[model samples]
Target chain A: MNPPVYFFTDFSSRGPYLGQMESAVLAVAPQARIINLMNDAPFANPRASACLLAALNDYLPENAVVVAVVDPGVGGSRKAICLNIGDRWYLGPDNGLLSLLVSNAGAENCSLAGLHESYMKAASASFHGRDVFAPVAGLLVNGQSPDTFPLPVDGMAGASWPGELAEVIYLDGFGNAMTGLRMRNLRDLQGVVVGGQLVKPAYTFSSVPAGALFCYENSLGLLEIAANGSNAGRILGLEIGSPVNPHISPGRSKNP
Target chain B: MNPPVYFFTDFSSRGPYLGQMESAVLAVAPQARIINLMNDAPFANPRASACLLAALNDYLPENAVVVAVVDPGVGGSRKAICLNIGDRWYLGPDNGLLSLLVSNAGAENCSLAGLHESYMKAASASFHGRDVFAPVAGLLVNGQSPDTFPLPVDGMAGASWPGELAEVIYLDGFGNAMTGLRMRNLRDLQGVVVGGQLVKPAYTFSSVPAGALFCYENSLGLLEIAANGSNAGRILGLEIGSPVNPHISPGRSKNP
Candidate 1:
């Protein structure tokens, strides 16, 4: 059975961009199962998108082919690459979008850089996510080998980036704020301080009262600030890449 | 060959909700091609979603299984249904969400009233999209027949609703405003009167200068108001369900 293909992009699902990308993939791999992991990744901010992708990676199927393109650098000199991180495979650009995933996968992971010039030459000046990466991803999920296509590399382009960022990486449609810090980092933390408001930890949204701002472990295993039945992003004046300071409760054990 | 499944919903793609729904479908139909046709449908406005779904249907493949849920009346006594419109199949609540599709497909179409009580009985109070529709859609694309599930009906609920809604049904992430009126309805129309601004028609965004407000036949064949390379929704003061008046240019032929 073919592993499902997941699409993660900053391409907002407006216009015909996303549809054209999906058509390109289906044209090559007709029998493939495609899941749109996200199309609304933060626009043009690859650094923020990288952290969101890493946090969201837990939900993606292991060994699946992921086509990630948060590329603000399309049509530029940026290299198109593929990464084989453990069992999962990713086809995207080298613009730091896949950095966290590659870095987190550790020493055993490998990247194949420089998509064929012939493929890039024929790709649209603006939409490589559709013309170039989609076909490459389609071919890969249909069983093409990385060695047969690109130059292999031991390190990814942005693999040297930080393990965890202190900035808000994504704000969902419901106004929940997803930070770069992992939930595992909250062992000694009692809450989050954002927009001049100190919010406490809750197990889930239901644990907090309506309109109450709270921090909780989201399903993505990230520290997220949300309001019960409300828009926390609007309430706390948070946006993508907003700086957040985690607060440690007095007497809380760091290792607990 | 299994038919592709498309999800058209008001359920914002923010949390684990959409992911969990996808997991349910994949659990049953592991090889299914699932497309997020639109996750950000106008919330709780099934009338608007119905129009948007109808306009968007032109892009979906025939015989596809579409799980459309815009039920503001979820957990209420509203009936869950299955509609066989031509070769396409739709599973959703009967609260006008699928009405446009049903009405547009004409008399040859058929509907199955009342999803099995056992299915609805097990559904969560607030999320029938995951509990009832997802599993049902999975079984369907995997070859289960509508005949084995529910009672047949000649007419669907809300099928008598108007063909065109002169209001904004959705605002895409790019801030383009998609009206419920199809371009076909504007035979004599020269422009639209939206937010007291007379917006003229253009072929494409690039046809006009940057920040110039214009209306065009979008890929979905709907009259979408956009500003060249700018946020149209913000500039025009338009949002989901905002009303607009179509005006005819004097001396212009209606047939044009």
Candidate 2:
């Protein structure tokens, strides 16, 4: 479509593919805008990375080529992938670091970048963020033929990540902290346990007594845990980099 | 709620109102968890403050109070407000600051606190973010009466505030500085005409050929002006803490 484009990399603990990706983008599509989405999720947690990926549609520029990398199962037996969903393309490990985007992007076709002799670079250990993912994305951004670099396959052993992590990604002006918990989860609080304490009767901050702990849907539509006139993060020991855990309620349907 | 809450306020920006507002919460509710929401929105332009508001929703605790203080017309003539949107309540000025949320919060039955004698903690000449808005929001969290503190007005004034401001706000890691452009006010093929030099379109570091000029959308979804391979903030002779005048497309609409 000849629109502006960028690369959104996850520079989490896995680090970044800045040099190679930058080189690839500069080598060809030098006119396309390139950006680093983020490389700061947890270590080797594809699910967490996926959660971040889900927020992309709402916050990222539409039509931008998002090349993300949060692969924990780097190297080894894992498979690298390029997934085209709707009008967008995502190049990363097929380990569901992109699973977070399933509900939104809806993968149309996924091809595995088989580690053949010509496909991969002479890389180092645990540095795929720089060596592999970055170059692949930049090459794609430059409109290079995908088949020119690597062959397509199916199924790479994805990483196993299971946790109810709702972190405070940012805070608002009015003192409202927006968590990773979306509106769907907040409105359906069944069995919520924060800091060894059970959150009962989840509702508005004002729904209960003044001092009572309350859980409700924040303006951004996420489930937030708060109290009237008190600091929930400090009092509950939930810091800026902490994750929220949502326990499964017994005898309840998963869907709300 | 009993969750940890943190606000991104600066020291002295909210001043006693921050603690006092927290105190107001404890005065009645006695057990509200109040965290520090930042008291800095680059002089508290409600529109500038609007960006902080949205970001906080992404990274805030499940339930917390964010206290922002970007009020320029603090004690002038603007009215304090509280919005009961979805599950969270936002407290701030009526002027277009919360304009972004009016449609989402069901502006029809939205709530506002009338000017109160008791809740007015001897407000300063121009520090509503510290004196008024903070304390009232604190009381709301502290389990105090929302209607008791102030009278409810239909809504605040200045719904359309485009072409009113004259500066830049936040910047990105790429040094692609985001201007205070109201999103809708940008036009196509609009050249950057600052000080008579026509800005060149350098999509990436290479396209600029000399890394002199670049333009693109920053990570925060705002149109940005940047310099390749160099800090545009420095090269362009602009400072993040300062302001700038941007050239917009004539047909661009203004954000409310």
Candidate 3:
């Protein structure tokens, strides 16, 4: 059986880009199981997006092929690459969108390679997500190996970037702000400081008063700020790349 | 081979609803080909949504199953329904959401039925889209005849609604406003009067000046208002259900 293909891109759901990419995948793998893991990743910021990708890594199914594309530098000199991390595969531009996940998996457990020349040659410079990465992911899911050569992990862009990012990486439809900071990365946190407001943490929305701003570990295990029964992002004036300072309790460092 | 399942709903891409519904579909039809046709339908306004759905009918592949849920009356007295329109199957609430398409198909080519009680009993009250409609769609796609009974098309809700709606039904991510009025419904139209501005009809965005509002037939064949390089919806303050007036040329009726 062919494995499922997950799409994580900066392509907003409104346009034809998401649908066109899926069609490209289905063109190669006729019966492939496809899912839109995320179409609203932070547009153009690979560092914050890398952290978000790593946080969502645990939710991916075994033997899945992920097409991760947050490329703002499309049609540029960025190389198209694929990485075999654990049992899953990731195909995208080697512009640090996959760096955090690769770093977390350790170099030995991850093998990186550039995509074959044939796939890249026929692709349009502006839409590699559809022309290149999608087809490569479909080929990988169908158990066909694309031509590639091994590459050193350290040479990847953003390889030396910090492990955690303390900024808003995404804002969901419900107006919840998802930061790049993971729940496990902090200890004894009192609250988070954002937009000059002290937003306390809560386990769930109902635990706090209505319209109250609070931070919590969301389903993806990322530190998310939300407002009970209201739009937290709007109320707190937070947007993608907004700075967030975790207020750790006294006698403890911010990061473990 | 199982038919592809297309999801069209108001469930924005941000939350887990769309993914959960897809998961429910895959649970029943493990090998099903799923596509998110549209997840940002006008929230809770099925009248405008119905017109939008009818406009998108031409894009569905033959033998495809559509799970459309813009149901504001979900889990209420509304009945879960399935409509066999032409070669495709539509599964959703029996509200006016399906009325426009049913009416457009000439009741003779359409067949209506109520979902099986077994599926409804097993579903949660608030999320019939995920619990009930999704699984039934899976069954239909897998060549399994789900238990359903015949119903009269004339008795369905919204059966008496108009064929065309002269209102903004959707605002895409690009800030373009899509009206429920089809392009074919107009004749020798000079411009559309929306928000007290005369948006001249243009063949494409390039034909108009940058940031100039223009109306054109979008990819879906709907009359859409857009700016050359700016957001027309934001500039014109058009939202779902916003009234749109079409200015036909002299001596011609508004509707052809």
What lDDT score belongs to each candidate, Candidate 1 first?
A: 0.79, 0.51, 0.85
Residue B6 CA error for candidate 1 (Å)? 5.6
Best by lDDT: 3
Residues B21-65, candidate 2: write the lDDT tens digits. Answer: 443333333445655555444443556556445544545554555
B138-249: candidate 3 lDDT, tens digit per residue:
8987888889989999998899999888999999989999998888878898999998898899999999988889999999888999999899999999999889999888
- Give one digit per residue, the lDDT tens place, for model 3 in A16-121: 8989999999998888888887777788888878888887776566677889999888988888899998689999888999889877888778899998778778
lDDT of 1: 0.79
Instruction: Using DockQ, rank the candidates from best to worst.
Output: 3, 1, 2
lDDT, candidate 1, at B131: 78
Which segments of candidate 3 are over 4 A away from where they belong? A14-16, A252-256, B1-9, B14-28, B33-38, B41-256
Local error of candidate 2 at A121, Å? 2.5
lDDT per residue, candidate 2, A88-162, as tens digits?
A: 666676666655554443323443344343445576667665566555655666666464334433233332333
**Residue pairs in clash, model 3:** none
Cα DockQ of the candidate 2 complex:
0.03
Model 1 per-residue lDDT tens digits across residues B125-151: 556777788888888888875433655
* RMSD (CA, Å), each prediction: 8.0, 18.4, 7.5
Q: Give the Cα-based TM-score of candidate 3 against the true structure.
A: 0.61
TM-score of each: 0.62, 0.43, 0.61
